[model samples]
Target: MKKTKSYKFKEVDLVSLRELALKVKNQTGFRLRYGGLLTILRTNVEEKLVHTLVQFYDPSFRCFTFQDFQLVPTLEAYSYLLDSPIAEKTPFTGPGTSLTPLYLLERSNLKTTCQDTLEDILALLIYGLILFPNLDNFVDMNAIEIFHSKNPVPTLLADTYHAIHDRTLKGRGYIFCCVPLLYRWFISHLPSSFHDNSENWSYSQRIMALTPNEVVWLTPAAQCNGHFC
Candidate 1:
């Protein structure tokens, strides 16, 4: 277990907070002071990560236009969308060019996560799809192990998420958390699923409403090519 200065630097929370402060201050000319600053601070922190991760790809995300969206999630609600009963958990070194959401979170015990703890860890798997259409040869390059020494961005994101996620007052379910929103965005662009539950008509309608990148991102052939997002 390495405890180098880099590890001790707490770069994850630091950078996340920095970004939160900047976002609140963005174009407002001055930071808005609120009586509920702490509550606002936590929201900013949570949304900052999600927004930063997806803004380039979706203006719906950049605008943060969802009405009922909350920054907190219940374990039951979070697991509903993320967990698969029969799926095999894939290690970072596990064979695959693309990392799916189930595989990434499957093995994580979620009891308590740490930067170097791969036996159990938490990660924001959304980056796998929204950030990279393809990891291409990520595992082959030996680029991401549990303890990512040179590139700890994944670990950082996971830790930052848990710090806020675990602490927020438990929310009703998946819709309360940002993860479901990200999934809603992704699925809006895909073909009808082989196993369709078709329950979220209103939510699906909202996601499919339209965005600047919708035309380009929804194009299956153009996914591999850049569409300015």
Candidate 2:
């Protein structure tokens, strides 16, 4: 068997950004479209659990293969998690513009410069930092392109798979995709009994001990009326 590489998971601190998102969410349609993004930011990622989950990733297959079952992140799952519509439009395909963040801010046409510009900048920051972050503290053009599409679920899922595949091969590196959203999608499949009774066990131990029948294969709450039950 080929030795899988050691990998690190990195997530940006979005506390300050979350506050900005809160202020602007109602100003634009942001709350209705991407509210789940803010919700997932509040979810605490158990890094140990994530690391153990990665160990089961079959890079060639691009899905988690445990002893008796397989799992993968799906677009529907992400759309539900994000509370955002899946755009039938194409996901971003970009050779992005070189505009700086300040320049981008200046281009916004809202009459109320202070409020409107703040909202615009907040959207960009959320895209760059929270949604498709490839660097710490920097919003690159790829993020800007995705922001323009107003379509993120496909790209989000693609980035996640790509990040895992890349890191699994690199042997030692950070997985830069949205960690919290991925973590929530993962644990949502666990049987409720496991969560209720496994408080004394380490996350890794609980996860590793799960049998196929113990996993919740379908979470109706995640699929019902686009709201998590």
Candidate 3:
């Protein structure tokens, strides 16, 4: 099977976005809705590592098949990673129109007087740019629907699976899900020893050297202990 290239969204001014997010962080229900997404946005995703990781994805099994173990992104894992609450409910059930980062950007500036509007636009930017990115600078109806549902964990996991599955089936293409989150999840499971000397080795080499016993199944961040910071 051919390895697929990792597709990352075009960069935006996250520093400004973070500043804006802080202004409204104290708003009612804002923190609950966005959780630690701002923190995750600051994560430095190693695209090469993520590309290598995707090479291990098995579409048929819907998991990353390593030497002796298989791993899949779970709702519980994402819930903990984001420090966001998750409920057992379906997300993005209804139809919606497509949006774009450009549209949200314009709205954020124009709605400076409205805290709630700014907050919604901020959430939309995070969802469209980071969480469920498909086209560059484009936020599709799916993202808007998921945002409205107020429950993103299920769809986040589903998109991760679907993106990998789609790419694997095509043999080569871009993986459109949240690459940073997936990268963080994969690294958090690595053994401590690997972390110490990881700089000297390629991601594929280091990952292939691991045994099932060497992987940390329960990461500290996954415990919802603020270790993700």
Candidate 4:
């Protein structure tokens, strides 16, 4: 029999991706598929913990959370965030760093239930990639003062995540973050798309609005924290 493609989240309902990861951790005492508790703790466990941290720091996390197969707060929210004056300045800099939503989340003390730190940083990095395509280059600019183009950043990010997944889990070359699989697992819970038209309607508009900085918006609260924890 042909085996169906599998994701980290699995096809189960009533369980968020984050909850699932935590469950895995609880059941096996670690996130890795194999033994070596310390190894799993270092990589997957740490990342999951960070996701929890960000959520705790930003109770108004709908902007980063997913909904109905799309991001929360809508693409419009992303537009508002980017169009804001702060987006133009260098992030992680004195004032500019303060402007980043990630920092805002960190300050809120929102509250999460995980034990890893590196994973949290990884999640934040991915979240940053989604929320700010030009996040890295806010200080210097050409005469045009335009942000460098990483158009279709979401697609590239997805590809990169997949590459990292294959390299780490399938190839054993390096450790990979579980967030991508975790995100995909959650996205699978959304209502399936109906129409087949590749380029038509608000759907595409909404997706284009995502940018790389907006993809994590694809993850949902249901997918992040089901009652399993």
Better of 2 and 3 by TM-score: 3
The candidate that wins on lDDT is 3
Q: How close is candidate 1 to the true structure, as a TM-score?
A: 0.20
TM-score of each: 0.20, 0.80, 0.81, 0.19
TM-score of decoy 3: 0.81
Estimate the Cα RMSD of every predicted model relative to the unseen true structure. 19.6, 4.2, 4.0, 18.3
Model 3 lDDT tens row, 1-229: 4444554334555676676677674644776657877667778877777888888988778789888887777777787777677876756665556776777777787834588788878888888778877666688788887877778888888888888788777776667788778887888788889767646988887888899899888676456644422
Error of 1 at 219 (Å): 30
- lDDT string for model 4 (198-228, tens) is 6554542333333444334333332333321
Off by over 4 Å in 1: 1-65, 68-75, 84-135, 140-181, 184-229
Worst 10 residues of 2 by lDDT: 101-110
Ten-residue region with minimum lDDT total, candidate 4: 137-146
Give the lDDT of residue 121 in candidate 4.
Answer: 32
Which lDDT values do the candidates have, in the order given? 0.29, 0.73, 0.75, 0.30
lDDT (tens digit, per residue) of candidate 2 on 1-229: 5464577876675666666556663633655544565576567787877887887788788898877778888888887787777889878876654445445444443456565566667767767776777755567888888877778889999989999888887766888888777888898888887766436887656766789899877765455646433
- Candidate 1 lDDT over 114-145, as tens digits, reads 32332212222222322112233122223234
Model 3: clashing residue pairs?
A: none
Residue pairs in clash, model 1: none
